[model samples]
Target chain A: MKIGYLGPEASFTHHAVKGAFSDEEHVPYTTIPDCLEGLITAQIDRAVVPLENALEGSVPITVDYLYHDADVHITAELVSPIQQHLMVHPENESRWEDVGRILSHSHAIAQCHKYLYYRFRGRALETSTSTAAAAKYVSEHPEENSAAIGNSLAAHTYGLKIVEHNIHDYHFNHTRFVVLSRNPILDELRLESEAEKTTLMVTLPSDDRPGNLHQVLSAFSWRQLNLSKIESRPLKTGLGNYFFIIDVEQSFEGVLIKGAIDELEALGCTVKVLGSYKKYSIVQK
Target chain B: MKIGYLGPEASFTHHAVKGAFSDEEHVPYTTIPDCLEGLITAQIDRAVVPLENALEGSVPITVDYLYHDADVHITAELVSPIQQHLMVHPENESRWEDVGRILSHSHAIAQCHKYLYYRFRGRALETSTSTAAAAKYVSEHPEENSAAIGNSLAAHTYGLKIVEHNIHDYHFNHTRFVVLSRNPILDELRLESEAEKTTLMVTLPSDDRPGNLHQVLSAFSWRQLNLSKIESRPLKTGLGNYFFIIDVEQSFEGVLIKGAIDELEALGCTVKVLGSYKKYSIVQK
Candidate 1:
């Protein structure tokens, strides 16, 4: 199966896709939308995109995209442990203190916030592509006035120095990535027994009234269906409302959940099922 | 008061800091950590750091740094609307069709996820510092195969063309930024009349340990304290615990909140009072 992910190869999304598919060759996309397009046009069999970073929270694009398409299905999930590093040009070793700036993706910079504060004190920090791009920049410049914080592979590829290692403030930092595909893989993967997830995107009516959200959330609680995550995204249709994405531990085909779906659809609102697949566990990482 | 915010000028964070302190001049910071350092050393009277994007979720560093000094206090908060643009070097506009790559901050790249997919089917997408940085990069390396998706100001500054504009999936994309300082600002500001916010940072003993989270949340629910936010940050001291950054509708100094604080502290967990400032409604641009 061909898989799509954001990449220049060493990106965390790439690692996540790699982690999810042990032996499958993955196609690289420059953006998440491209990955989505690949799924829509049948260019790829599956695509993996980040849904939420433990530190960064839920990615709205993933939510919005799911809201945009009713057919896109989430087949599996993966979580990548975010480990940021400081990579600098090897030629600028002794002059490291001369480094006046640091470059990385915004999230990378944000992930290692405390370390940059304590270590760099007052230095210019710019955002760039994957840590690999940051390392590439430092390698091309080879100036002590700049450095980049990224992954270990970035340092090796660009011949950069590992000035600092795993510098993220939180030791348990991790990001969750979701796999999307055009055709629903739930039925095919169900035989594996490990497949145990169902994600749904539901849009409620535009009236700002009481007990609306309670009614929606109760649909799951009443069925004893464990809700994993719930996030809202604007419909952007100027409808003055939002769509909610809910992840349940059990498949939607289950009788109790199917009954809950009926109750939700009967609320005089729009509810669309996104996908059902096996829960990608961290223990598998 | 001298305030620090991520920017060169006209950056989203720059606009946010201006919104936070309309009458004050804010010094531009190249990175979020530099802004945090400025707050730690009193290099600036206060610093504005984007904590969470309504559409994108939390900015990890802002949460991690709350536990840095235990002395740094969040004196105020504000939210700014974000509208991403697709800009390119002016001289390279005729090559739009030939462009094989696009660049911007990862979040910017994510926000314009669908737009990129619909527009460029098989192009390489890259990341940079804000959209402006992407514009700057395209300006420096004017290749027919590259374009940048960012802010309009960046395109103007770098003599880039607006290949596309307002491509973010969500129309109401707003980010919440917090004003932080070394010593808490006890002096009432002109906005005191509108001040109705209470921010607190509490270190929980552990994660998902039944009563730990329930107890802390109950403090607010029991006292009828309207909690606006509850963010989790991994406590870095190897205690295998986490901290909860909670924002309520009432001032921390209020008598009602005082009782809540006592009840929260009695649970054998550490709670640091962050700030109690006037909350202002965010006006979307």
Candidate 2:
């Protein structure tokens, strides 16, 4: 089996792919769209992408692409704890004050905002395509007098030294990654012990009426189906127009899920089931 | 009266501040937190900040700050059309092929991703604190062979030449701004012709039960109180814990809105009314 992920190498997505599929052949794509496109073109069998961060909420590009650009189905989900480290070139000797710049992806920089503001008050901060790319750059150009915030895997991959470990502001930072494939996974391939989840993309009728969304939710509420998440995204047609993406904590095999969709359609909502899959949680050691 | 907005001048927030307050004494704050702090300290009578963008969804920092960090109330809302331009130093004679780098705020760069990828395929892209700051940097360092993605206001303020106008990927780009103040505006001070909106911050009972959110929404559904927007934000306590921010289509003074809140509180949810204000929409010239 082959897997595609967002990378330069040793990025969080790279870690996720390794954690979920231990011995698979993995290819790295530079951008989220590229990874999805590779999957569509059969360049890779599956693609793992970050869906949301516990601290940062959601990854907009991933969500927007899945909703608007691609015709992929989510086959499975995984959660990985994010541990960012401050790394430097192994041969360089520099104190915090001697460093002139720091580099990482924008989200990683934001996650460590408090520490960055206090320790490196006046240093220039730059963003790279990925944290591992930052590590690779620092490793290649040792004279830059810079450090990168990335994972221990990146430090090992790029031959850098870890100056500090778990430097994020919050201790409970974790990112959720979803595996997307061209076809839905078979029931026999799913792990029986894992919890089942179904995701739906819904749009209300064009009429500007009261309780339009209320009626949609009532379909699930009346059936006692639990909703795990609900988010609104702009339809991109104009301002004040939006569609809701909902996640229900149930499998699609039962009558309840199908009936709820049928009921919603009757209430003038456009509903599409994105996927029904099992969720896997991985704890990093 | 005095107003504070995110600025080094010629920013989108600056335009919002000017549009809302024509002749008021205006001050510029370096960050969103600083602008909110100015209002809390009575340094300014009111502050205007970006809440959400049509393309980008929501500004997390602004939403998080308003929810967790600051003790402020929103008094009015405004929407402004966003127009991005490709600007260069007037005296520099460089074609698109000669440009080695592009600069803008991260959101602006992301908004023009297609254009950037096609025109300057391998050029280095850098992020500044604000789009206007990128324009200023380009104007001051003409020898760097860099252009900026910003607005006409930024071009005028920094004396840069606009090489291309309206370069955003989408034509319907808009940003929503909210006015914050320490004290709520009196009902008599509001414009009667404007539409009324009441924003609420709600937290469901800590128990993990099916339909907890469903019951909360049912409170409004039964009362036929229309909701314009609903969003979930991490409470920062831990993963999977969230607080919902809801916008209703009517003022709090109405019986239906009040009854809905009473019903939600009865169901063991903590609800707070963030504001009841008039909505404003401004079109750029």
Candidate 3:
């Protein structure tokens, strides 16, 4: 099976794909929208893309594209603990202290800003398109004598040596990647999954009505459905028009889930079932 | 009284200040944290900063700073209709096509990406520190023959002429700015605020609990205290941990809102009242 990922081959997303589906054929797309677009267009059998980071919140571009443009459904969720590391090209490992610049994605750099400020005070920070891209750049230009901050997988993939492990500010950094496919996943994705979840988007009527959100939540509330997450994104229609993305902790085939969605639609809400999938956890190496 | 805003000058936040507090002294702080820092340190009586955008959702830096770092209170919310315009220095106004590059803040540029692709496809797009800064750069280097995408305030302040109005992808684009101070707002703001609001931060126990969010909403749902927004941000703890920022459309002085707060506290949830204040809307010029 061909599984595509948001990549320059060594991103956290790429690492997730490698750990979970190493035997499968892998394709890399440059952007999140391109990855999803590839799935809907049948260019790949499955696409793995970052949905949220524990520290950074939702990946807005991914969510926005899914809500506004893409017609793909999530088939499985891969949650990987993110551990940003400081690394240098193998040739520069001994003289890493002489590094003059640090390169990584903006988010990765922000995650380790304090560490950078305290230890690498005088070093310049430059943002690459992705953490993996930073790793690649450092590998290709070892003479520049710069370091890259990224995952250990990046270090291994780009033949670099990690000088520091888990330099992120918080110990709880993790990223959620969702597997998108045009049809329900049929391949035997041999991985351990502890829970099943169904995602839904509920859009309230445009007219501002008091308690409208409460009513929307009530559909699932009374059914005793446990929601793992609920987020509001603007409908892009106006100031008050919002569509709530909800994650219900249950199988999509359940009658209760179907009933709640039916009730929501009955209430003049636009409801879309974005996914019903199992959640998998990847242990950090 | 003195007011601080996220600025260079002529930023949307600065424009909001000028429109609402023409009589007060205005000070410009380069970043949101600096403005809020100025407020907490008593350097300024009030600080105005962007909170959320109708299209882009919440600004992470402002939200993160408030949640994890600042000991500030929101006093008022200023909702402004955002209208991005394509403008050029007066010298190049007639020959805009000759303009080689378009400059603006990253967010502003993303807002008009579609427009730029269709109208100015080959022109280079550069990101300035801020929209107002972009305008200043354009004004300073008219010989460069560049255009900028920013609010009307930037064009007017920089003495440029707007060639295209409302070039943003979404016509419903608006940004929500919150006024922050060390105390509740005391100055006569001299602007029309239609409704009062109370903002609360509710953090569930670290232990994952089913139906906890539903119960939290029930506290307000039963009271019929209309909610304007509910956003979840990671508590900087591990996965599945979140703190909900709820906006109750009511006054701070209300007994019912107080009852809800007590009920939440009784439920063993950590709840903090961020603010109970008014919301003002700014019309586009």
Candidate 4:
């Protein structure tokens, strides 16, 4: 299967694509829109995008893209622990205080929130995608006292040294990525336990249109479907437009899920079932 | 009064401050942390920060700040129409297509989502805060083809011309900014209007613990107090930390509001009433 992912080769999205399909042919796109376009045009069989970062919250573009293209279905999902490493030139003997600026993906900067403020103090921290890009920036701008926060893989790819390792505030810092495809994959990877988590996307008519949301939530509440997260993204194509992404801990086969979806459809709005994935289980400390 | 606002100057936060207290001394800070620091150090009387944008959703940082700082009260609020303008240096003759890159604040890029795809299709749009800052980069790096999205004032300040006007997708796009101060300004703003809005910072015991949120919401649900927003932010200095910022449509005087607060406090978690203020009305479209 040919899989498309957002990247300059080794982004988190690229890693997500690899995690989803091992032997799949990887097609890279510079922008999420291009990756989406490829998916719509059938240039690739499936695509992966970061849905939410523990640090940055929701990926707005990814949510917007899924809403715009109704045909795509999220077939699989994964939450990878994001371990951020600070990389700098090997010969550069710059103290942490001397560093004028640091760079990483915006999410990385957010994950390293406490550490950045405590260690770097008042220095300016900028953002880019893959840690590899930040490493590249550090290499090219060697004269400036700068560093990058990314995975250790980025340091190796761009020939930078690890100034600091695991700078994220939380060890459980994980990014949840989802796989989207035109056709649903039967017998997709699942735990021995049946998948209990399901995701859906819906566009609300208004942002502050008074208890309009309460009405939508009541459909789920009435049926006793537990909502995990409800995120809203502005609809890019139209004014005052928004897409609400909801996650519930229930199966589509159940009465609650079906009834909720039926009520939503009855409201004369579009609702797409993204996928059902078993929530990740980590051994307790 | 001296007012602190989030900025490097000419930022939306600055504009918000101007809208609320035109006669107050405006102090600009580069980051939200800096603004908080200014407040702590008494560098300014109060600060205005974008808490929520009607288009892009919540300003997590501002929300987090209010959540962490128990002493800070939201004294006043203002919601302003946010219209973005494409700006280019006056001396440069770069056509829209000729521009290799577009630069503006991240939120600005998000606001013009439709226009970027439809009008300036394929051009790489980067993120910065001030449009004047983008123009400055273009001015210094004359060979690079870049334009910026900013207010008309920024275009004039940076000696840039308006390439396109009002590029936001939403005709009624607005961002709500909250004025925070060390001491409560409730009594002062109350003379203008008796109806007040209060914002509070809440730290839930667990993010994923089942029914914990329901119990919290039940407080307000039982009393029928209208909740305007429920926003979250990562705690800046704490263990396993996250902050929940909530906006309610009524003052603490209402029995419902007090009951909700009493229940929230009974949960053995931190509940800080940031401040109560006269709810500012948005200009009619």
Candidate 3 wrongly placed segments (more than 4 Å): A1-49, A53-61, A87-106, A116-162, A184-192, A205-209, A282-285, B1-49, B54-61, B86-110, B113-163, B184-192, B205-209, B282-285
Best by DockQ: 2
Residue pairs with backbone atoms closer than 3 Å in model 2 (clashes): none
Q: Looking at model 1 chain A, report the run of 10 residues with the lowest lDDT sum.
A: A186-195
Cα-based RMSD of candidate 2: 4.4
lDDT of 2 at A76: 87
Note the DockQ of each predicted structure.
0.24, 0.33, 0.30, 0.19
Looking at model 4, the pairs that clash are B73-B274, B74-B274, B74-B275
Q: Which stretches of candidate 1 lie over 4 Å from their true place?
A: A54-58, A86-103, A113-126, A138-148, A155-165, A186-285, B19-23, B54-58, B67-73, B85-103, B113-126, B137-149, B152-169, B182-285
**What are the per-residue Cα lDDT tens digits for candidate 4 across B211-246?**
555566666665666666654454544322455566
Angstrom error of the Cα, residue A229, model 3: value is 0.6
TM-score of chain A, cand. 1: 0.86
> What lDDT tens digits, residue by residue, belong to model 3 across residues A150-230?
998889998999988889876765678888888765334677776788989888876677677888877887888878788
Flag regions of model 2 displaced more than 4 Å: A1-11, A21-47, A54-58, A86-110, A113-150, A154-164, A186-194, A282-285, B1-15, B21-49, B54-58, B91-94, B97-110, B113-147, B186-194
Give per-residue CA lDDT, model 4, range A1-285, as digits (tens): 888876656566665555556677999775565676789789998877667643322355566556664477777666566678788877675564477799875546655767987888778877564455777889788788689887765676677888788887667445666777887553265332335678888755544454455567777775667676765555544433556677887766687788888888887657888776554321111
RMSD of each: 5.6, 4.4, 4.7, 5.0
**Order of the predicted models by lDDT, top scorer first:** 3, 2, 1, 4
lDDT of 1 at A85: 77
lDDT of 3 by residue, B117-151 (tens): 68886678775546887899899998999999898
Quote the positional error of residue B237 for candidate 3 in Å: 3.2
